[model samples]
Target: MEFRFTVLASGSTGNATVVQSGDKTVLVDAGHSLKKLEELMGSQGIAGHDIDAVLITHEHSDHIKGLNALARKYELPVYANEATWAALERHATHVPPERRVVMGTGEEVRFGSMAVRSYPISHDAAEPVGYTFTEDGYKLSLATDLGYVSDLVRRSIIDSDVLVLESNHDPEMLRMGRYPWNIKRRILSDVGHLSNEAAGEALCELMTDRTRRVYLAHLSLNHNMMDLARLTVNGVLEDRGHFFRKDEHPLRDTHPYEPTPWDQIKRKAL
Candidate 1:
């Protein structure tokens, strides 16, 4: 079995990713418009019809903006926890009955050739969670849109072969930026998005020799820069003598607005 994941698009504007195992493909998040989601998937040689499932992390607009349309367009199953499903109904009103699948955190769901398990995350949304995918012994963890990493999250992703984790902002930048005080406080709170330092600290506890790649995700457009996020994560890893390949280090996707594909890392042996 072969497992592959791609960051089709990642940022505050919209978020979406593709995870594939052989002929089975699952889309995580549909934050962009239907057209935009199609373009992004097409750029990676995938079509809307090929998506078997859509797993949502939360009900935030940046994560589920196009979920209703995408699920309706492709007749795909959309899975989320009860609260998230309830929240999604408010935003993605057009999603039909059959397509809205309710899944609970920590429940293992399987597709054609892979298994996915969602774990609780520290986001303010309605029971937000991250996911872990395992296929033929290889693991890929996706944990973005989270404020801080919890012990449960650390346990879920510790031995992952590839980690797409959040490094949302720089604390200093956020504090001094123009976003309102309440928004800033929420961001800095435990249930808010992870700052670069917080993300790196989480990585320190999660990375191991078996971990092959790390992709820093969900960066704030106005508060954080790609270089700064990368530098912060790299610095943390290096300080602990856990260096990584240039590609394996946390890096940002270049085209935040377009359907983009990052270099796909092949599944590594366990």
Candidate 2:
């Protein structure tokens, strides 16, 4: 089977991703406006009606800003944990009850040829999770908007063919930035976003020969630059003996305003 992944947008401003297996296509989050989501999907030849479901990572506005609109417009099934659904019901009231599907963490759900499993992550929200999708022998894991990599998270994403991990900010830049102290403290806390150095360290333990592509995601526009994130992550990987190469464990970049080109991973038939 062939599995495809695309980061529609990844930053503190918004977050969304597309995961496709066989004929089924799932939108991981609808963080942008309905119009913006449509445009982003259109760029990849996907229509609103083409989506099979929407998966919520948490109830944060940056992750669910367009959930109600997109779900209602497409009549799409929106899967989320119980706590997240409760928070969504209070905020995203436009979504019909029939469209709300409760998915438990660590349970494998099938959407056509794709099997998706959610794992808990430490974030200051009702419930935040990172997802891993598998088809045949190929696996693609997405772990973003997380503060730290727990043992569950590490195990969930192990042996992934593609990984989308967070490298949110640089410690020095975030410390010196003009944000208020409380806001900075929250970001620096374990319940906050992951720093670039932390992401690199986690990757050292996570990346393996099976891990082909890793996209640095959920970057802070003010606290991080694309080049800087790549350089920092690569540097840490190199120092830890994980050399960067285009054909092996290459680091990829994601955009906050656009969609990444579809990355396809194929597995041989049994």
Candidate 3:
């Protein structure tokens, strides 16, 4: 039983992830157009229709843009919580009747060859939640768009082979940057995005023996650099007695949600 994941895109621009077990594949988000997504999957030697389902994290444009269109093109099922569905229903069109499965926080939803659990998050929305996927004995946890990682969210991320966690910005950079005071304040709020330091600190607290790979994600293209995100996570990891050289960290797919092998680490997923 082999488990893999991939990222279609990361950062504030767009976000998507593909997780698969053997022949079954699931897309965590579709932030790109169907054409772009199909091209990306092709680059990885996967067909667009190979995706079994689409799981949305929130209604943010960056995460939801390609969802409706992708579903239209591929006729794929979409699994999202009730509130998330309500917010997105205005955009739903072309999705088949059996394709919408409304879920809730802390509930489990099963697809072929894998079991998934959704848990509430602190993002400013109606019951936004992160996802945890398990197949065989390996676990992959996906959490982004979180303002602050709560105890419940923290506990759900434990014992994983791969973690696609968010490190949205650097406090110093965001604070000193030219963004307006209101936007900055909103970002710093509990229901806002996560800062590099905050994300690192949260991971430090939630990590365990089973947590091996960590992929920093949902970065702010405006205020943060890849090196900055990597450095922050590495710094926190080292402080918590879990250090890895920059060259030694696990990488994600070219897009978000792309999987790296559980045992190998790289700058980007292959």
Q: Highest lDDT: give the candidate number.
A: 2
Candidate number achieving the greatest TM-score relative to the actual structure: 2
Off by over 4 Å in 2: 246-249, 267-270
Which ranges of candidate 1 are over 4 A from the true structure? 244-255, 259-270
Give me the displacement of residue 24 in model 1, in angstroms: 0.5
User: Taking the tens digit of each residue's C-alpha lDDT, what string does model 2 give over 103-221?
Assistant: 99877899998999999999998888889999887999999988899998999998788899999999999999999999999999989999998999999999877777889999999
Q: All candidates' TM-scores?
A: 0.93, 0.96, 0.88
**TM-score of the candidate numbered 2?**
0.96
Better of 1 and 3 by lDDT: 1
C-alpha lDDT score of every prediction, in listed order = 0.84, 0.89, 0.76
* lDDT for model 2: 0.89
By lDDT, the better pick of 2 and 3 is 2
Worst 10 residues of 2 by lDDT: 261-270
